[model samples]
Target: MAARLRRRLALVALVRVFKPGTPGVGRRLAAVPRLIAATLRGQYDGAARLATMAVAAIYLVSPFDFIGVAIFLIVGVLGDAALVTWLAGALMDETERFLEWERGSGRRPVA
Candidate 1:
């Protein structure tokens, strides 16, 4: 009941965060570097997400994969694509959260 409602709300929020043509695409893209910098500088707010993103990145490059290359090449490629898609969504969600935190904490840029 309560947990299900929370899950539903979270799904809705995730969709809202990553919807295509959402404004600030450039700003969001720019935030990737900033996010990395912040994470490296010891900001732990998004450390878990950053760690997952890093692992996804490493999996993309690593020769060994859960879906082995020797197995169907198409399946391996599809697995990689799925991982990339998840990575992109995760990045967007984390960046949106970071932006919200920045605004609420008086770190918003002067306009």
Candidate 2:
């Protein structure tokens, strides 16, 4: 799973961030606000998932500061690791989905 996640995130960054054309990382970054708006407007069925991911993100970092890292060094590091792993995978996947939706969206692409 670790190797798979590593490959997935690396390839995504290579193709989406470095490669030109299409939305890529920049396009996905731009789409973030739109994605949120769409989710709020009842456009995306995965809105609950998005909220859960966000909450998990917040939960991961919040209490870790004062309780996890300060008292338990190993636990702090583990929390950090989980944060990196989860956020990296989530960002890569969500952006890809948003890009696909953009391509299939109602607005036709300009030649």
Candidate 3:
């Protein structure tokens, strides 16, 4: 099970690293608004997950950070990339969880 989880993480990381031409990019982008709507309606099972996503979004937009711009520039642009990657992964994971919840609750949209 642990190995399976590790492999899943690696896969997600690789997908995020090579974004912009991936198969699920469009679907994932579409899901973001739906996720937010579901979240607003209190449809998801976990408030903690929603709050964490909110915090991540805020952090991404805020100019302040633990690492200054000068420091990031010195580090060859790793800090921003790492933060964006983490945010993307978190959003994708949260959206997927919400989708599962929708299906489980019999609220999934009919295609």
- Please list the Cα RMSD from the true structure of every candidate, rounded to 1 decimal place: 5.7, 6.7, 5.8
C-alpha lDDT (0 to 100) for residue 15 of candidate 2: 48
Clashing pairs in 2: none
The alpha-carbon deviation from the true structure for residue 98 of candidate 2, after best TM-score superposition, in angstroms, is 1.4
RMSD versus native structure for model 3: 5.8
Clashes of each: 0, 0, 0
Q: Model 1, stretches more than 4 Å misplaced?
A: 1-23, 109-111
Which has the greatest lDDT? 1
lDDT of 1 by residue, 12-82 (tens): 44466646755365677777776677668775266776887799899888878755855878888788877
Off by over 4 Å in 2: 1-23, 108-111
Question: TM-score order of candidates, best first?
Answer: 1, 2, 3
Tell me which residue pairs clash in candidate 3.
none
The number of the candidate with the highest TM-score is 1
Pairwise lDDT winner, candidates 2 and 3: 2
lDDT of each: 0.64, 0.61, 0.58
